[model samples]
Target chain A: GQQVMQIPQYQHVQEGEDFTTYCNSSTTLSNIQWYKQRPGGHPVFLIQLVKSGEVKKQKRLTFQFGEAKKNSSLHITATQTTDVGTYFCAGQLAGGTSYGKLTFGQGTILTVHP
Target chain B: DAGITQSPRYKITETGRQVTLMCHQTWSHSYMFWYRQDLGHGLRLIYYSAAADITDKGEVPDGYVVSRSKTENFPLTLESATRSQTSVYFCASSESGTSNYEQYFGPGTRLTVT
Candidate 1:
């Protein structure tokens, strides 16, 4: 079975501080997707990284994929109050009979205090 | 747009009772998935369907069953509910089952079993 592990199960920071969450997969992934869930809300798609050593940015957030495609990270710069939520990384394994299946990490709960 | 919706946003049941959660998507997406979210367990897949009448198990499919009688409807049933099954259930849909597709999630359904 494939597993995706995320670090810092919970994090709290000042509004202006930076935060980072790491995700590692036990198996190589063909692609990885990031999602965010606000308090009392459903998960929403954020971004996806496919190539090895890939890096993508959206506003204050930066996402990076490891060269081996077995790990990924999300870094938020100068976090805002609106950034408080849970961040999850899901990995799609690279192999047969496992297509369309995504293994999600336990997720990082981020809270920013003003 | 009313992309996806889940019925019975909240539910309460007792042991040995049968329960069903309904999921519908207006996008006519080809892929639909059911996942459960609990404390310390971010989100675990229960079942997924590639199309009408084509369903498969996911990471945490035990004690749960799913059916896709039509392209827009995917229902999940619990034959015999247990306290351990108490969690937030989410239904998601995507245009395709490919690894690159982005999933659209519905407002989750919270079920409490006593």
Candidate 2:
């Protein structure tokens, strides 16, 4: 069975500060996806990383994939109150049988204070 | 309306009772998934369907059953619920069952078993 581990189970940051969460998979992944869930809300797709060593950005947020395709990281700069939520990283194993199956990390709960 | 939706946003049932959670997507996506989210376990896959009548077990499928009679509906049933089955359930759909597809999640259903 595949597993995705996430770091910083909980984080509290002052507004305008920075935040980062890391993710690692037990097995190589075909691709990785990131999601965010607001308080009492469903998770929403944020971004996806496919190529090794790839980096993608959405506004003040940055996402990176490790060269081995087994790890990833998300960094948020100048964090705002709106960024308070749970962030999750999920990995899809590399195989034909995988078929849209995602092994999700435990998730990092982020809290931003004013 | 247009996106994925789950019925009975909140439910409370007895330990030995049976429960069913409904999931529907208007996008006509080819892939649908069911996941349970606990406090620390994050999101564990319960079952998934590639298309109508094609379903497979995921990481945590025990005590649960799923059926996909049509492309737009995937229902999950608990034959005999237990206290351990109390958690938030999310239904998601994707354009395809391929590695690169991103999932669209429904609002989620919270079930409490006493």
Candidate 3:
């Protein structure tokens, strides 16, 4: 079975501050995807990282995948009040008959105070 | 301009009752999934379907049943609901059952059992 762990279960920061959430997987992943869920809302896909040591940016947010493909990190620069939500990382196992099933991490809850 | 959708955005029932959560997608995806979200547990997969009449269990499939009679419809049934089943359930669909494809999630259904 595959497992994913996330760090900093909860985070609170002032507006304009930076926030980062880390994710680690028990097994090598063929790909990883990030999702964000706002208060009283459903999870929305953010981005997906496939290549090892890949880095992608979306405006104020940056995502990076470890060279080993076993870990990932999401960093948000200059966080705003609207950025408050829970961030989740899901990993798809590399081998076996997985059929694209995803293992989700516990997630990091971020709260930005303005 | 249609996407995945879930029925009965909110539901409440007593223990030992039977309830069904419906999921519909217009993308005609080959893969569909059901996941439950709790406070600490990010998203635990309950079951998934790979085309019509093909379904498989996921990480947390106990006390739940699923059927995919059509390519665009997948429904989850709780034959005997319990208090522990109180959580938010999300439905997602992917273009194919491959790691390279991204999953699109539905709004989610909140259920509570007394």
Local accuracy of candidate 1 as per-residue lDDT tens digits, B1-114: 789999889999999999999999999999899999997899999999888999999989999999999999999999999999999999998877455778889999999999
Segments in model 2 whose C-alpha atoms lie over 4 Å from true places? B97-99
What RMSD value applies to candidate 2?
1.0
Looking at model 1 chain B, which ten-residue stretch has the lowest summed lDDT? Answer: B95-104
Segments in model 3 whose C-alpha atoms lie over 4 Å from true places = B97-99
Return the interface RMSD of model 3.
1.0
lDDT of 2 by residue, B1-114 (tens): 679999989999999899999999999999999999998899999999999999999999999999999999999999999999999999999987455679899999999999
The local distance difference test score of each candidate is 0.94, 0.94, 0.94
**Cα lDDT for residue A65, candidate 1:** 98
Give the per-residue lDDT of model 3 (tens digit) for B55-77.
99999999999999899999999
Return the DockQ of model 3: 0.79
Which prediction has the highest DockQ against the true structure? Answer: 2
Q: lDDT tens digits, residues A1-114, model 1?
A: 899999989999999999999999999999999999999999999999999999999999999999999999999999999999999999988877653668889999999999
